[model samples]
Target: MMLAILIICSQITIPLPGVPLTLQTFAIGMIATMLPLRDCLLIIFTYLLIGSVGLPVFANFAGGLPILLSPLGGYLIGFLIYGLITSGILGLTSRSSLTICLANFLGAASQLIIGGLWLIPANHLTLSQAMTIGVIPFIIPGILKLFLVVIVAQRLLKARLLAR
Candidate 1:
């Protein structure tokens, strides 16, 4: 149920090119913290596959090969990394709110870093330019999403889904 919701949430976008803010990363982090690592990775991979096959499962209500080849591709790739870190962290720790929050925070940071690094090189953005356009506007939202992911993860964990 949660997996289905997350995948659909991933496709919701805010209509920005290369920067359509979506809950996919948050969902990934939350799922990672709640599910076992292998299941998390599989679900994330499947989500990506669904988008890659020309489905309108990406930003701007757009998908297909073109969107994948666009500038946002790097961030799309980074989603997988997001799952690995957050879920891996959750897997390593005993279930707790703080642990889940920390894992989501780190996962969010990793996603931001991955996006910034990829954007700089792909778009020929200098550090200052990239920081200005990519990282700065996102910090607050990212923090909020981190908090939300943590809350959701803890809720799922409390429901005894962590061991499933």
Candidate 2:
């Protein structure tokens, strides 16, 4: 069910220069908060596999190795990184709203860092340029999403609709 939500969220995209703004991070945050570490990781890996095999499971209905090889690929790979890191944090600490918020934000930061570095080579951009186009533009929106995820996850956890 969460994997399906993630796939649907990936399609909800707003295209930018280097990367598209999608609900992927938000969904990832929720998944990390609600699911076990191993399960979250598996879902992410499966999502990537489905996208890689030309399933149109990516933003703007794009898929296949070419899309995965694009500059935006890092962001896609970043999803897995985000999932693992957030899941690890959630596993090690309390599943309080504060902890969830912190873990999700950290995961977002990891995504930006990895994506920014990958952009340098894939887009033939300088480090500063990559940060400018890839990371900076997304910070505010990412924070908003993190906030939303924290709130929603907390509610779901309280309601017993989601696993801690």
What is the C-alpha local distance difference test score of each model?
0.76, 0.89
List candidate 1 stretches off by more than 4 Å: 16-18, 161-164
- Over 63-123, each residue of candidate 1 has an lDDT whose tens digit, in order, gives 7776666667777777788888888987888768888877777777777777777778778
Off by over 4 Å in 2: 161-164
Instruction: Please state every model's RMSD to the true fold in angstroms.
Output: 2.4, 1.8
Each prediction's TM-score against the native? 0.87, 0.95
Per-residue error at 73 for model 1, in Å?
1.2
State how far residue 100 of model 2 sits from its true place (Å).
0.5
> Which pairs clash in the backbone of model 1?
none
Per-residue lDDT tens digits of candidate 2, residues 86-143? 9999999998989998999898899878988889999999999999988999999999
Error of 2 at 47 (Å): 0.3
What lDDT, from 0 to 1, does candidate 2 have?
A: 0.89
